[model samples]
Target: MSAIPVKSKIPADQQLKISPFKEVIKPTVPHKHANYYELILLEQGGGYHQIDDHQYDVSPPTAYFLKPGQTHCWNFSCIPIGFVILFREELLTRECLDIVYHLPTTISLSNSPSLFELAKQFCQDYRIPASQGVLNTYLQLILLKMNEEMATPAPGHQLFSPVYYQFKALVNEHFLKIKKIQVYAKMLHLPPAQLTSICKTASGKTPGMLLNERIVLEAKTLLSNTHLSIKEITDALDFSDASNFVKFFKLYTNLTPGQYRELAFSRQQ
Candidate 1:
């Protein structure tokens, strides 16, 4: 079995890109991106997009957000026409980062003509090769508008504080090796209890739960998309042994790694 492919569509020196979505003649294989965020707006299309474990239908005037390290693929029945915006996290401000982290993975822009117009301008500006400051301003406006257009508030949207987003970013960066809430709190220069309160207030989940969720997400991605054996995955994830990894996985998903992989493959077929 082959390893899952990691694709980088953007050039190395460039930190941001905007362009029209290219037509796909066939389904794309499962793949992940590294160290970038992608926003795909579809004005006209048919079929569905598979992002990690969820599959969302590609209705017209819809938007999909892809975060770094998340696996996704596209299956289009017809050509898709819209804009694709890719940018490194460094391009975003703290406020933009907060919005990006809280925005729903799938959004319906049917009622938001302004967003489509903004995307059109985004493409135009990219063609002009606008200054980085200009492009960054446009990206921030887009995120703010999307946040306003969400039909319903994302989970914990009201309670989200800067600390929460900071904690989330840290967890994403260190979850593979660090699992303790105390360590995360110390890194944040806060006490464990204070961090716990902030996380709970912001997301309605404990710090430990969030850490486990990130680990599980990575485990599922590897199990479903990569050819690594169970032992290999266990080691990659820093588990002490295969048996312990299996037990931990089963505790969260009720399915062992092998079983989850089989189910994921069967669905693709």
Candidate 2:
């Protein structure tokens, strides 16, 4: 099979985004791509990259998993030869993406030699002719490696961390209706405060932050990918009105709905 062509529009059917960047591409400053999950396989050179608030040295064999809406930067590094795969959480079998979610999303390459080697091999395989039927083979191997890592026992307080992953999965499922933190608490059978504490322990973010991040990301996707107006986005996100939705978007992104649409559309042109 020929290498699948790079797509202009992100597809809902595909569970992954795979592509290579070459020839000294200078990407913009640190920013987040809302609503998609990213797995990057770095095959060359070094630079500083930030995942959320954590910055790390990027080098060969570095693999980073960035969750939806987390801020990141490639501008800190020069053109680093690599392949990036961005997929929606729903694309994978629950078991596959779930294993990835269990890992610290912002992992440093130095911490996991096994994962790093797998990422390197995946990159090399990705660059081979798409007909090699090798892409699926390597991708599966990487997912298997992730599952292996998740099953290992780690020291204190980490074993129970899976609860927060479950909480995130629940939020992804219910974010449209149950925006309130308390609703998630009730659904998960934990007190609201206790749920918040668990989220903080596992993801270094509060429950409310996690919920809002998903909503904001979804809002951005609707705005960019559809012809929806501000009112529609407001309704889709379950906000009271366009005004409230605008306020929420601004609060997190510093961009109102109109401004965000303008910027996102401008990029396409």
Clashes of each: 0, 1
Tens digit of per-residue lDDT, candidate 2, span 122-148:
656655645434665566566666545
Among all candidates shown, the one with the greatest lDDT: 1
TM-score of predicted structure 2:
0.52
The root-mean-square deviation over C-alpha atoms between each candidate and the true structure, in angstroms, is 2.5, 8.6
lDDT of 1: 0.86
Off by over 4 Å in 2: 1-9, 23-25, 91-95, 106-137, 146-163, 169-179, 185-269
Q: Worst ten-residue run, lDDT, model 2?
A: 1-10
- Model 2, residue 78: displacement in angstroms? 3.7
Clashing pairs in 2: 1-131
TM-score of candidate 1 on Cα atoms, chains taken together: 0.88
Each model's lDDT comes to 0.86, 0.66
lDDT of 2: 0.66
TM-score of each: 0.88, 0.52
